[model samples]
Target: MLYWWSKFVLLGPLLRLLCRPTIEGVDRIPESGGAILASNHLAVVDSFFLPLLVPRRITFLAKREYFTEPGAIGWAKKQFFTGVGQVPVDRSGGSAAQAAMSTAVRLLREEKLLGIYPEGTRSPDGRLYKGKTGVARMALEAEVPVIPVAMIGTDKVNPIGSRMWRPHHVHIKVGEPLDFSRYEGMAGDRFIERSMTDEIMYSLMELSGQTYVDLYAASVKEKAAAAEREAARSDARDAARVPGTRAG
Candidate 1:
C-alpha cells in the first residue's frame, strides 16, 4: 500500500539517511491495540519524523489546511500526508472540536494508534505549554493509555521559517504509558480533565526537559505577534513626529 511504499520505498528511507534520528524507549509503545501517543510539538517535522521512526503506523489528526493546499506541490504534500495515514481535522468552529474528538474516539475504537499534541500547537519558544484537556477527555472516553513522547533536535533540523532541512541528528524519547483508567466514565468532569492533562504535561516536561509554561502555546504566539505589531506602529509614530519625515 501507499503507507508501506512511502515508509520503506520512498520518503521514510530518505529521511532516516538524512536526519539520522535516534530513538529511545520505543518498546514502551504498545505492540497492539489502541493507545494515544501524546507528544510535545516542537517543529513541523516533529509529526513526520516520529511516524517515520516508530515501528507502528501512526495516524495524526492534522489540520485540514495541510490537505487542501493547491498546485503540484500541494498535491504531492497531500499524497505524502495521506499515504502516511494522517487524518484531516477541521478546527474552526465549536462543533469542529467536538467532531475531532469523535473522530479520535472512533479511531481508538477501531484499534488504531492515534498521535495527539496535547499542547494543541507547536511550542513558540521551545518551552512546553499547558495542554488542552481534549486529550484527557479522549483518553477517558476511549479507555486507552497515553504514551508520552519527546522529540528533540527537530526544531534545529527544520526550525521556524526555514525551508531547507539540515542534517541534524534528532532524538526521540518515549516514556511509559500513562494509565487514567481510574477516571473512567468521568469524561465530562472538568476538574478530572484538568488534573489528567496536567499529569500528562508533567510527564512530557520531564521527558523533554523543556520549561513548562502554564499558558497555551497558541496564545503565546498570538501575544508575541501582537507585541511585534505594536512595536512597529510605535516606531512609525516616532518617525512621523520627526520634522521633515514622510509617513510613507
Candidate 2:
C-alpha cells in the first residue's frame, strides 16, 4: 500500500516532474513474471529514478547500512525503503554474498522483478566497470531473463556528495532480455559466471556509451584513494622542509 501510494501520490509524481526522466523500451520488462534488471550504477539517484519510472515494482538488494541507519531521520529512511520493497543485503564476501544471491533467486522464483547492479557499486567516474558474477548466479538460479538497463544523466541530477537534486534530463534505455538458459546448471562454475557477467556488462556499455574498465569499480576506487593519500603525504613532507614551517 505504501509503495503504490508513494509511487502514484508522493515521490513518483514529484520525481517525474523534476527529473523529467525519459525511458525507452519499458515494454521490454516482463509485465507479469520474474526477471532481473541488470543495470550499471551511476549515481545513488539511479535506484530512485529507475523505480519511479518503471510501471512494475522493482525490488533492489540494498546494502544493510540503508536499513540500519541510526536516529529519527534514519528511522524514516528505513521505513521508506522497507515500504518500497527493497531488501537489505550484506555485500561482504563469502557466506554473506551467497546469502544475498539466494535471497535474489528466491524473489525471482516467486515472480518478482529484481533490480541488480552488475558493477556491484557506483561508478567512481562515468565509465562502466567490470561486473561482479553474483547477478549472473541469481539469473541462472532463478531461471529468469536478465534485462540490461542504462541510466543516463542521473549523476548530473544527483552527483556524489551533493545534498540537493538539480534539474537534469535523465534517460533510461531498456535492452532486450538476455537469456542464459543454456548455462542453467552451471551456476557453480566460476568461468561460466564470469562469462555471463561480462556479457551483461558489455550490453550495458553498448547502451550507455560509457568507456568500459576491465577492473572492478571497488578496486579502482581503492587505488584512487591510495593515490590521493600518497600525494597528500608527499605534500606534507615538502611543506615541513620549508624554512618557516615546523618539521614533524
Candidate 3:
C-alpha cells in the first residue's frame, strides 16, 4: 500500500511529469511468477524510473547502511526506502553475501519481482562492466528467468554528484528473458556461474548499447580512486616545495 501510495501519489507523478519517461518492450516482464530484472547500473535514478514505469512492484536489495545510518536524516531515508519497497541487506563480503543471496532467493520464492544490478555497482564511466556471478547463482537457485533491462538517460536526469534531479527524458528498454534452465541444479559451480553471468552482461550490453568492459565495476572504481589519491599527494608535495627553489 505504501509503495503504491508513494509511486502514484507522491513521487511517481512528479517524476513522470518532469522526465517524461518512456519504456520499450515492457510487455516482456512476466505478468506473474518470480523473475529477475537484471539491469545496467547507470545512475541512482535507475531504481526510481524502472519501478515507476513497470506495472508490478520491483524490490531491490539495498545496502544496509541506507537503513541503519544514525540521525534524523537516516530515519527519513529508512522510512522512504521502506515505503518504496526496498529491502536492506549487508553488502560486506563472505557470510553477509551468502545471507543476502538467501534473502533474494526467498523473495523469488514468494513470486516477487527482484531487481538486481549484476555489475554490483554503478558504472563509473557509463560503460557496462562485467557482471558478478551472484546474479547467476540467484537465478539458478530460484529457478527464475533473468530479464535484461537497460535504463537510458537516467544518468542525465540524476547525474553523479548532483543533489537534485534535472528535467531529462528517461527511457527503459526491456529485452527478452534469458533462460538458464540448462544449468539448473548447478548453481554453485563456478565455471557455469561465470558463463551464465557473462551471458547476462552480454544481453545488457546489447540492450543498453554501452561499451562492455570485461573487468568488474568495483575494481575500476577502486583504481580510479587510487589514481585520484596519488594525484592529490603529488600536488601536496609540489605545494610543500620552496617557491622558486629547485629540489635537491
Candidate 4:
C-alpha cells in the first residue's frame, strides 16, 4: 500500500517527469511467481529508477544502517526506505550474511521480486565487476530464475557523491532469465556457485555494455584507498624534508 503510494503518488511522478525513463525487454519479467532481478549497480538512484519503472513491486535487501540511524530525520529516512520496499539486513558477513541469504530465500519462496546487486556494492568506476556467489546461492536455494537487469544513464542522473539528481534520461534493459535448474540442490557447492555467478555477471556485462572487470568492486575500492593513503604519507614525508616546514 505504502509502496504504491510512494511510487504513483509521491516520488514516481516527479522522477518520471524529470528523467523520462525508458525500459526495454520489460515484458520479459514474469507476471507472477518468484524471480531474482540481478542488476549492475551504477548509482544510488539505480534502485529508485528500476522499481519505479517496473510494474511489480521490487524489494531490495539493504544494509541495516539505513534504518538504524538516530533522530527524527533518521526516522523519516527509515519510513521512506520502507515505503519504497526496501528491507534492512545485516551486511557484516559471516553469520549475518547467512541470515541475509535466509531472508532473501524466504522472500523468493513467497513469490516476490527480489532485487540484488551481485557485485555486493556499487561499481567504483562504472565497469561491471565480478559478482559475489551469494546471488547464485539464493537463486538455487529459492529455486527461482535470475533475470539480468542493466540500469543505464542513472549515474548521470545521480552520480556518486552527488546530493541532488540531474534531469537526465534513464533507461533500463532487462535480459532473458538465466535458469540454473541444472544446479538445483547444489547451493553450497563453491565451484557450481562460482560458475553460476559468473554466468549471471556475463549476462549483465552484455546487457549493460560496460567493461567487465574480473576483480570485485569492493576489493578495487580498498586497493585504491590504500594507494591514496600511501601517497598521502609520501607527501607528508616530502613536506617534512623541506627546511622551513614545521611538523604539526
Clashing pairs in 1: none
TM accuracy, model 3: 0.96
lDDT for each residue of candidate 1 in 136-183, tens digit (9 for 90 to 100): 999999999999999999999888888998898999999989999999
Scored against the true structure, residue 242 in model 4 reaches a CA lDDT of 93
- lDDT string, candidate 3, 50-132, tens digits: 88999999999999999998999999899888877799999899999999999999999999999999999999889999999
Better of 3 and 4 by TM-score: 4
Number of the top candidate by TM-score? 4
- As for candidate 2, its clashing pairs are none
Task: For residues 45-134, write the lDDT of model 4, one tens digit per residue.
Answer: 998998899999999999999999999999998999998999999989899998999999999999999999999999998899999999
Model 2 over residues 1-248: C-alpha lDDT tens digits?
88887667767777888888889999999897999999999998898888888999999998899889799999999888876768998978899988888889999999999999998889998899999998888988889999999999999998888999989899999999999999978878999999999999999999999999999999999999999999988988998989899634
Number of clashes in every candidate structure? 0, 0, 0, 0
The TM-score measured for candidate 4 stands at: 0.97
Q: What TM-score goes with each of the models?
A: 0.96, 0.95, 0.96, 0.97
Cα error of candidate 2 at position 19, Å: 1.6
Model 3 C-alpha RMSD to native? 2.2
Q: lDDT of model 1 at residue 220?
A: 90
lDDT of each: 0.92, 0.91, 0.93, 0.95
Q: How displaced is residue 5 in candidate 3, in Å?
A: 1.1
